[model samples]
Target: MSWIKTRLKSFGYAFNGLWTLFRTETHAQIHLLALVVVTVAGLITGLERWEWLAIILTIALVVAAEGMNTALEALSDALHPGHHPLVGKAKDVAAGAVLFCAIAALAVALIVFLPHWL
Candidate 1:
């Protein structure tokens, strides 16, 4: 119980970072909106058991990656506090990771949902 409490306390910073990301990040908002739509469509379309698992897993992975990326960018900016090419490139790379996850999620959706729609 004590260990768990200490672990949770350490997560306060992460939670704060996540809240900041949700409030300030436009792309994060967009991803969340898409997550809602995809979840609704999957449920309404009666996806197969495996499809449900894939859809849920993909959403989790993408969102988790986005959150981590947001944290990384924020930390980097705080540390650098000035315009540096390396910092800029690092941020861009983090953003690109989110984009890759979004694209992969789209592919997963097409694979799982296309037969029904087509």
Candidate 2:
């Protein structure tokens, strides 16, 4: 394939993965709802450019963390259909990473929005 075609195919795969994540993952759906709420709040509050950048980056961080966690869980399940302690540990770690990212995202949101509300 040409370089452009290869890049396009890669993007298509990424989009398909994103669709699967949002369609089948409850956590992803919740994140989507949160994203919508944050977007509306930002618009209503009229965020400055830097505030919008922080919000956008934080949202991306959360989504990427969630996606990585889902991917790890799916792979673990497929590789070891039976319960295994190490696999469980790995999955837990991945989930913990997502939780950490989520907490950080919440902090960023509060820092960006609290002043506006106040």
Candidate 3:
């Protein structure tokens, strides 16, 4: 019972984090909108199991990367509070990571959908 309670508490904390991200991050809202659009497209196109798996993985990867970028930006802002060269570099790197993930996800979506579209 204690172990189950601990796992549930962990899930609650994760949910709280996700809620905070969506509530506070404009980029998260955009990602969520993209997610909805992708999901609808996948359904309408009748994606195969493998295509669905790829799309799901890509979505998860992009979202996770964005979450990490957000966390890093927040921490960097708090620690520096002003424009410091190292902090700026770190923030840029974090943003770049999100961009890379977004681009990769876009590529995956195109590959998965092109056949259905054509």
lDDT of 3 by residue, 5-86 (tens): 9999999999998999989999988999999999999999999999999999999998999899999989888888999999
Q: Candidates ranked by lDDT, best first?
A: 2, 3, 1
- lDDT against the true structure, per candidate, is 0.89, 0.95, 0.93
RMSDs, each prediction?
2.0, 0.9, 0.9
Clashing pairs in 1: none
Which runs of model 3 end up more than 4 angstroms from their true locations?
none
Scored against the true structure, residue 118 in model 2 reaches a CA lDDT of: 92
Q: Residue 55 in model 2: shift from native, Å?
A: 0.4
Tell me the tens digit of each residue's lDDT in model 1 across 3-111.
Answer: 9999998899778877877789887888788889998998889998999999999998888889878888879989998999999998989889888999999999999
Give candidate 2's TM-score: 0.97
Whose lDDT is greatest here? 2
Q: TM-score of every model? A: 0.85, 0.97, 0.95
User: Model 1 RMSD to the real structure?
Assistant: 2.0
Give the backbone clash total of model 3: 0
| Order of the predicted models by TM-score, top scorer first | 2, 3, 1
- Candidate 2 lDDT over residue span 61-117, tens digit each: 999999999999999999999999999999999999999999999999999999999
Error of 1 at 2 (Å): 2.8
Model 3 deviation from the true structure expressed as Cα RMSD, one decimal place? 0.9
Candidate 1 C-alpha error for residue 48, in Å: 1.3
